[model samples]
Target: MARLRDRLTSLSQPRYLAWRALPLGSFDPRFARLRIRTLVMEWHRTRETPDDKAWCEQTLEALGHEVTPGIWSGEVNGLLWARPRESEARR
Candidate 1:
């Protein structure tokens, strides 16, 4: 896991690899679950709270995603592409 750690560390900094190191995954079910689990754990450790559900919900909303009580997934391209309100868009 040294390689993964090294990669994570290297990409965690403000550099060209930052975006690439975001732990994003694709069609691979195992890797996708792993990335989500790791992100949740890290977020919890850093925040010192296990209330990520709220944060996730808010973020999804801000990103124009439609959140449902029974479905709170973090799938790829899960968030919606928000558009400004009618008045705001016209401004």
Candidate 2:
């Protein structure tokens, strides 16, 4: 995920694919529904409304993720990555 963080920062527009191929019995059940890319997109799509923002943030937190809108960042467990901000892109 360190590489993911670096790629997100360096690329003008970086995209990611969530890891979902783990064996059903190989890991914790909590991670069964954690599709990282989907989570980020859902956040980006619904960040406009206050209710939606709260819900998404809460959901991410419940999944043991840390989300930072200011940095366009999201961390899954310990893995971390970020998207470039609109302001930064214009600069």
Candidate 3:
């Protein structure tokens, strides 16, 4: 698809493979929200700071997400709710 082609052209990398495999809806406008917005797979990479990874958990709490060892769930911006599980510890 054009989107995939565009993405590949912009930056080719292994990480992009996993990113591309995500559901189409995952790219919805919500994912592009301002800093401190909702995130999916990568907690560290989603933090507000451009190069910082420590804000993930703090931001998640602010958004009402509860994190356990391998699971997390809650509403983001009070508009969306999610419950995802991590297969590996500390992922």
Candidate 4:
């Protein structure tokens, strides 16, 4: 199954392994969630093309996320927050 394959792939990633190895008893759940979200956003930003805003929009839509545009350092940029598509959200 795709989920299983994805899990397996994550297990092999050092960053995922390190995150998993954090002491759960001492780790704040809110901080953990924020850290993961920030990492994912940074990953997307690294792949973003400065001149190609459309590419960013299309990529996020395909991944079922709605993005908000923001001003960053005089450039129009995005602050991404992941949410399910309307059809999926109703379910």
Best by TM-score: 4
Q: What is the lDDT of residue 74 in candidate 3?
A: 33
Per-residue lDDT over 1-91 for candidate 3, one digit per residue giving the tens place of the 0 to 100 score: 9999998787765433232244532332342232332245443232333422224444444434543322442333112222332332123
Clash-forming residue pairs, model 3: none
lDDT of 2 by residue, 1-91 (tens): 9999987776643233322334321333544344443234333222233354444455455555555564443332222233333443234
Candidate no. 4 TM-score: 0.34
- Clashing residue pair totals per candidate (backbone < 3 A): 0, 0, 0, 0
By lDDT, highest first, what's the ranking? 4, 2, 3, 1
What do the candidate models score in CA lDDT, each in turn? 0.35, 0.42, 0.37, 0.43
Kindly indicate the candidate among 1 and 2 with the higher TM-score: 2
lDDT value, residue 51 of candidate 3: 28
TM-score of predicted structure 3:
0.26
Better of 1 and 3 by lDDT: 3
| lDDT (C-alpha) at residue 23 in model 3 | 50
- lDDT tens string, model 4, 1-91? 9999999998786444222234422322343233222223321222333443455445555545555554332245444444546664454
Higher-TM-score candidate of 1 and 3: 1
**Runs of candidate 4 exceeding 4 Å displacement:** 1-48, 70-78
Pick out the ten consecutive residues of candidate 4 with the lowest summed lDDT: 35-44
TM-scores of all predicted structures: 0.27, 0.30, 0.26, 0.34
Candidate 4 global lDDT: 0.43
